[model samples]
Target: MARPDIVELPLAGAFHYRPHPHHDHRGSFSRLTCDETLRDAGMNTTWVQTNLSRTKARGTVRGMHYQKPPFDEIKLLTCLSGCVYDVLVDLRPDSPTFGQWTGIELDGAAADTLYIPSGLAHGFQTLSDDVTLHYSHSAAFSPDHQAGLSYRDPQVAIRWPLPITALSDRDAELPNLKILEEAL
Candidate 1:
């Protein structure tokens, strides 16, 4: 597989990577990330941590979460199995698009990844059962720096594709944009 072709996403600092996967009788292989590719995009090439999550049920939503300054991080997100309706909300106070959001469908079979910049709260709804996601983070996690936004926030008004079947108690009670803006 060759280097992924990066496309600028609607949100400034966000990017979508379309990589060429090699397919043959033996199966397929794809390059999830490349240092030069990331460097060209002015993104952090050093990943401090890699996390894997597997959601068991469809229609379950996980996030609208971000980190505060000193721990805010860039992330490389990819769907490893099943599919998802991924979403991101701009939380950068100085950003022109602050309070705005964008959603994209990510298919597991597709060798694609999203370059998530700091100051963006991200979350996704599982489109199929047993969905797995991979995240490569530029900074280590800090409990004190963890933060989130409510999916029910009318201000952001995210139109999730499915009726949310499940959510963590914490995510359900997350504060809205107005409340988090000052801290973010």
Candidate 2:
């Protein structure tokens, strides 16, 4: 048999993905983060905060959020238990992908991950009854610097899998992308 070569694909500006290998029984494992892999992808940022969250129901939705300038953070997110429809929107005015959005389906079984660069708003909808998501943020959480766009905004129509059964009051009240652009 011949060995398989590893490759990275650019999903969007500053966002990349590489297939990971998984071994049996002890559950699966993947090197979702590696200095060499990151270096090759040309993403030169350090992560400082790692967070994990588990959802109890299928219709859970979170975010469409990011921090403001000077505190804008870059992130890497992975689904650890079930699955989710991950969404990202470019908020960088000067970025070529500005105002554009991308979506990816990630599942624990698939071991897929998503890389979100700074100046993007991110959110996800649970695709399974119970799901756990993990993320690493380059900056510490700052409530004062936190900002977001409405997940249901028509300007960037994101087709979530289900109606959000629950959302934080803050997340539900975020302005739309158009409002965000006007604020800039």
Each model's TM-score, in the order given? 0.97, 0.87
lDDT of 2 by residue, 15-98 (tens): 535446677878655666776667666765488999998888888889899999778998887787798888888888887777
In candidate 1, how many Å is residue 124 off? 0.4
- Model 2 scores a TM of 0.87
Q: Could you tell me the lDDT of residue 78 within candidate 1?
A: 89
Runs in model 1 deviating more than 4 A are none
For all candidates, the clash counts are 0, 0
Candidate 1 lDDT (Cα, whole model)?
A: 0.91
Every candidate's lDDT: 0.91, 0.78
Report per-prediction Cα RMSD to one decimal: 1.0, 2.9
Q: Highest lDDT, which number?
A: 1
What is the lDDT for 25 in model 1? 100
Relative to the true structure, candidate 1 has a C-alpha RMSD (angstroms) of 1.0
